[model samples]
Structure formats: C-alpha cells, structure tokens
Target: MAAIERYEQWMARLLLFNKPYGVLSQFTDRGSPTARPTLSDFVPVKGVYPAGRLDRDSEGLLLLCDDGRLQARISDPRFKMPKTYLVQVEGDPGEENLEPLRKGVRLKDGMTLPAEATRIEDPGLWLRDPPIRERKSIPDNWLKITIREGRNRQVRRMTAAIGFPTLRLVRWSIGDWTVAGIAPGEFKEISV
Candidate 1:
C-alpha cells in the first residue's frame, strides 16, 4: 500500500497533475457514447477530487486535493489564485494587441480583469498534436498571458476579439505549481 493510504481517513494532501487534452475532469461520463478515462485513470485516490477544472479541449496543470476544505480553498474564486497560460494565436500580436489585455478587455459577459503580465514570447515550448492550421499569408506568434480569473474559454475569446484568433491554448502554471518536466498524459505528486 502507498504511504498516502494510511492518511486517507485523516489529513488532506495536495497533488499536481498534468492534464492532457481530450480528458474529462469528472470520474465518469455516462453521456458520452465512447469511453474515455477521467482523473481516476491517473490518480488512484478514493476521496480526492480536482480543485479546479480544465476544459476537455484545454490542457495543462491541474490541482487535486484529498480534503474537501483544501479543495474549496483552491477552487474558490474568492482566493483569487493566478493562472498563467501560453497561448499560440493565429496572427502576430503587436504592442497594440496587448494593451487591451493588460488594461482589461470587455467581454460580452463582462469586463475581464487585467492580466498580471503579458509577454510576446516564450522560447521554451513544444508543438501541439494536429498542429494549428497555418495561413501561408498570415503569420502567428506566441503570447504568455497570466490572469486571475478562469472564465470559460476566456483566453480564446479575448485573443479573437483583439484580431488574433487563438490557434491553441495551454495552461502552463497555476498558483505556485507548474507543468514543467511532465510530459503529456503524465502526472507527478507535488509537495504543497
């Protein structure tokens, strides 16, 4: 048995997982016609659950907690934890393209909170499977954007509004945790 087995009934522990694309956040999905494994396929804890959810279409760092209290603390927007994303947009994002993001873009739902930081590039990156389509005439660029809120498809929408559609989106980090060193569909326990 694992060391964590002994503490199952008592203390709660935090774990970091690298959630790969196309995996659902829930343990079971009766609605789907086909079978696809959930976090259970990667994590074998009984009481543990994801703190926050990454969409089935999105991929990146995910936090799970064995304790309900700790789960609430991390998932709650009240905590205001920052999430950083490395986005590949459909076109070159110039200085002008970043201003609205830094200042805060007004989405149809509401005004998005300003990003903590926005940079033009991140040299350390990898190509995506089923690579984003290329428009021979139009070039694309990468942007590392960090924001506190996790609105549904917010990054994709924001970039599209700024005249640069999002070709791909990946959450690189959340709070103090990151997806570094872990490959796709792989996960490792992180000390909180």
Candidate 2:
C-alpha cells in the first residue's frame, strides 16, 4: 500500500455495533423528560461518531467511524450503498403487496428510489425488552428489504404506504457488512 494510504488505514477505525431498541443513535441527549439510553452508554470508543443513524425504535447494524472519508462513503446516498433490512410487518404481505416498494413510493419528502424487496422466513431474533404490542386479529409477515437511500424513517414509511405497517424492523446488513455475530448493545472494531 502507498504511504498515504497506509497512514489513512492506520488511522481509520470502523466499528459495527448492534444497536438495541430504546437507545438513541446519538452519544448525548440534548433534552428529554425521560432519561433515554444513548450510544455512549454502550460504546467505550472515543472520537468516533455514527456514520449514519438507526432510529431509537429500530435495531441492528450501526456503523461508526472517526475517518471522514470512510464515514461519508457509507452515509452518503449518492454512493448507492445498499442497506438490507429484515422487516416484520403487521399483516401478511405477499409478493403483490411488496411490488410498490420495489417500484418506489411517493412520500411527502418526494419519490423514493426503487428497492429490492422479498419475502423472508421468520427471523429468530432476540426479544426486545418491552416488546411490541400484540393485537390478536392482526397477522404478521416478514420481508427482506434492500434500499440504497437512507432517509429518515424511510423503511417504515415505505411499508406503510404499501398498506402493511412495519411492526418490527431489524437492519441485517449495510453494503458488504453484516450484524451476524454482534448482539444488542455489543460492538466489534475493524481497521481497514
């Protein structure tokens, strides 16, 4: 490797954290009546910030970095890095129900780019502490969704637009990275 490249790699730190539900994506809380948990509570590493955000209600792969270029490459939508999600919607969503998401949906923010979506088997995941509400009449379905754009609450909105509200959402992968081995509130560091 070139000297500059070597130096950059030596300085770059990438951390893949499996963010738990109810934990804020940020390190600090500006203001809130309740004392919600934040990333700082779990991540001991200093000088690193989340490359992108996973809403407090969502769970799974969250990437953090101290390197500016690496952060931008992963967070910027222009890069078209795919983010895969394992979504559990409120009702059974067959292939026909997911077509609009694949074609793209129009939101108040504007039209979203097309997504790669498919039905998936039930993911035997760790239970959330409080747990999602159980409505006896409403059935649930699982879908694996891949979208390149990272918009605020995009996945939830997309599923809602298709008439299948997301009950539980888990981000399984981002680009070439996956949250396979990490458990909630735990992280693994990698140097690249």
Highest TM-score among the candidates is held by which one?
2
* Candidate 2 RMSD to the correct structure: 2.2
| Model 1 TM | 0.87
C-alpha local distance difference test of each model: 0.79, 0.93
**lDDT tens digits, residues 68-129, model 1?**
77787777877878888888788677788799999989999899999854656654665556
What's the TM-score of every candidate structure? 0.87, 0.94
- Model 2, runs deviating above 4 Å: 1-11
Residue-level lDDT of model 2, residues 5-106, one tens digit each, is 878767889999999998999999888988889999999999999999999899999999998999999999999999999998998888898899989999
**Relative to the unseen true structure, what is the C-alpha lDDT of residue 39 in candidate 1, on a scale of 0 to 100?**
80
TM accuracy, model 2: 0.94
Model 2: how far residue 145 lies from native, Å: 0.3
